[model samples]
Target: MKAAALLFIICVHLVSGGSHSLQYFYTGVTRGINFPEFTDVGLVDGEQFVYYDSNTRRYVPKVDWIKNNIEPEYWTRVTQIAQGHEANFKANVGIAMQRFNQSGGIHTFQSMYGCEWDDETGATDGYEQYGYDGADFISLDLKSTSYVAPVPQAVITKQKKDGVAAEFMKNYLTQICVDWLKKYVQYGKSSLERKVPPQVSLLQTDPSSPVVCHATGFYPDKVMISWQKDGQDLHEDVDVGETLSNHDGTFQKRAELKVTPVERKKNQFTCLVEHKSGDPIHMILTEEKIRTNSAGNNLPVIIAGLVVAALVLIAVVVMVVKRRSGIHTAHDET
Candidate 1:
């Protein structure tokens, strides 16, 4: 019974068409921000937020914030904060730039407090004012300068770019979904997971004319194709083609479409390929030439053959007439 069950499971996997090799899809916003600098504060304060995935041992953006915001503007600001922290620390290191740049390991300092001008007494007083309380404050005359190791600027720059890019992508994707929902009015949530690649091809009758549009993928349970002209859905003068299976293990699918050259040239035609997953892939074919021609089409070849035969016959007739008229003998003798 156990063996039979194992065999059944294997059969089920084969029949069901197991998942495609796992490929990570990373989409997000990346932004760059200027770091702050400060002088004379004497106290160095630096902070960095390192993101990591405990389960996958990979670094990925925090997803919760992204879904909730659904806007690029918000994520752009978050990236600024993360980058600002790194820049602030670099300024604190001051003269330690060389050492920090060389190796960014931990560096410690002992006597960091220094004797400087008092806020109340000004530069005349040697005592350093330590507190904001009315008159009660501690005073230390001994002055020493210390540098806290700076944050690695390279690291900061990379993080800032990545964060911003990830956020931007997220927002872009969300907007796509919103637009699709507004237009379709029937697709349910969770439709974004089944996205397939877009299709571009030549129209059937006119091989020289190219048709660019989106079609449903191979294995998707449901799919839709739409064309837009001047930002409006085009219903007339557009022919929707059939979908074909890839027969591959994955869910890849394709569909054909036909549109007139006028529509294609106007840039008014867009092929929107949508699956249950998310935003559809939009494709525009600008070129008029078709991508493929049927091998059986023989009109051009037949015309060329007829022209060659006519030229050969004309040459033969001229040669015979010259020979019969004795012109061939005269020409040869000369």
Candidate 2:
């Protein structure tokens, strides 16, 4: 049972699809002077999957994406893996708890099984440790037989010479999880290539302002936005800005190029954006194309002022004409 649980822990780490499938197996056994002693097993599937909290005795999932989109068979296999570890892990913890009580030590026994792998770099590493309190008493590395000190070189050398480490890795880690990973990749294809086409715009704070090429709402993170002079890419007077996140999950970034008042009259600057999903987006920067900061404000303000002035002028002319007519009527009557 120990061997099986250890192999499953290694297999979970070995599974990668453009990202690591980091899973942690945990067990804890605690007993107070008067309280009852109990042990439980836990399994945590990172980020996209579920976590079995031994304390709660329930499986809590991070997202429902797997259940909604993933095939039933795939999830069933994952459930089996979790169930198989439950009893074995509890039994292992019970043994540790018995040992601690026999020694008359008041301590908690905890063990963690972890797998760390880097998908881009193709690095696979994991460790299993059992200890009381916070210090580990037993440690094993699945990668190699180079055991640390206090674990004698003779023992490690003997294990290495016997090829124990190599056999364990091959038989358990490599072969067990191949079928599951194949289906996981298919179900997670959208996550691997999820992208939003960039929305590009050429803008200026004012008519004579520096031209900025902006791109927003893109995914998979990295993008290139640049200022082009005539047909070539401009390097001088270019301020390449950093990409920033939007309120939504996408990202936004802009690159600015200083444009003089004289340069604004010419149709020489163009903004170019490159992203994975679509063809390069291009926008020619011209005086007419540059959007001023107060472009929409000026027209409404001017129109309102003219209407108010016309109303005041009309009122004054009517008052003066009425006064003249009253004077002429009084003169005629006299």
Candidate 3:
């Protein structure tokens, strides 16, 4: 939250592989914010593939494989669909602002659509969620085949725009999204499947601050980062972070352990990073190895640390539709 505006937890898209995932993210912002009116990003297996923004007005591939392999017609179709969604999203944001009786501030309307597929078993499932001003706006209930809004303001939308969004999402997640995901996996097989070892480091801003285990440049987005004290796994006072993508499509993660000088001297602390790309890296926590810096803002928490407890995967928090608002607010699907 930032000064009367909802500061979104700007997430780098998370996708899956093997067992692959496809994620489509769309964001529409209030006018006068100078941000893009609409932006869309698509990711497969945690790698960003495509991007589109109001300025470009065209769907562009973010990766070489996607650019070289995908047909122009596919891009054209995606652009057209995204254009339509942009129009509707902008309008919806405006209407929503009016309904909320809001004025003179930057507001955002965001949507995340994700799909998960297990290649071996062909098992497929996914989730679709939307948010307004940092709060869960709406979500889908595949079992009942209806839309649900956890918030009071969105209830009107749930009633009037019920099955249409759910049906489209269901079809998209099962058919269109999954089909594209398979192609993405096929196109980027070499890079997606390749393993790269992580560069591990021990960091600390000051002795009073927590000891940080920073792992960088790992591939496949799957890696284990943990701390060991005296040859035993140490779980307490540790703040382990989720994996995040680097600009080059590699992944990085960190875990923090709080300790005092006395504890550090008495115990042998080691940071371990295990990745499929290579052997596990062990960095023993020694005074000489712990790099100290005063800059805490260097590592910013860009995305929400939302964890999903489900058979599928991580999902954005969902809101229930409050009572119906008389007028049906049309939320467009991208």
Best of the candidates, TM-score = 3
> Per-candidate TM vs. native?
0.25, 0.38, 0.83
| Model 3, span 1-334: residue lDDT tens | 5412434454434444457877867777777765678777777787777887888889888889888887788777777766766787777677667767887587777777777888988898877777777677777777777888887777877776576556765666677677767878899887778878888878777779898898877778888899999989999988998676666777678899999999988989999888877788889999888776555444333222121101012223222222121111123532
Candidate 3 is scored at a TM of 0.83
Name the 10 consecutive residues with the lowest summed lDDT in model 1. 313-322
lDDT for 48 in candidate 1 is 8
* lDDT by residue for model 1 (99-212), tens: 235334222111111112212332211111111001111212222211111234323322332333333323322343233222221222133223344443323335444343
> Which of the numbered candidates is closest to the native, going by highest lDDT?
3
lDDT by residue for model 2 (1-334), tens: 1211111121222232354433343433344433122222222222224444344444444444446775566445544444444444445444544544555444433344434444477564544444434344344445553332222312332343234433443233333332333344455556634767997766666665667777767764567888888889889999986554343435567788887877756647888898877888888876566555577534333223333322111100000001111001000000
Quote the positional error of residue 331 for candidate 3 in Å. Answer: 5.9
Give the Å error, residue 106, model 1.
Answer: 84
Poorest 10 consecutive residues of model 3 by lDDT? 305-314
For all candidates in order, the CA lDDT equals 0.28, 0.45, 0.69
Task: Please list the residue runs of candidate 3 whose C-alpha ends up more than 4 Å from where it truly belongs after superposition.
Answer: 3-17, 32-34, 294-334
Kindly report which residue pairs in candidate 3 clash with one another.
149-319, 149-320, 149-321, 150-319, 150-320, 150-321, 151-320, 152-322, 155-322
Q: Tell me the spans in candidate 1 whose CA falls farther than 4 Å from its real position.
A: 1-217, 249-258, 288-290, 294-334
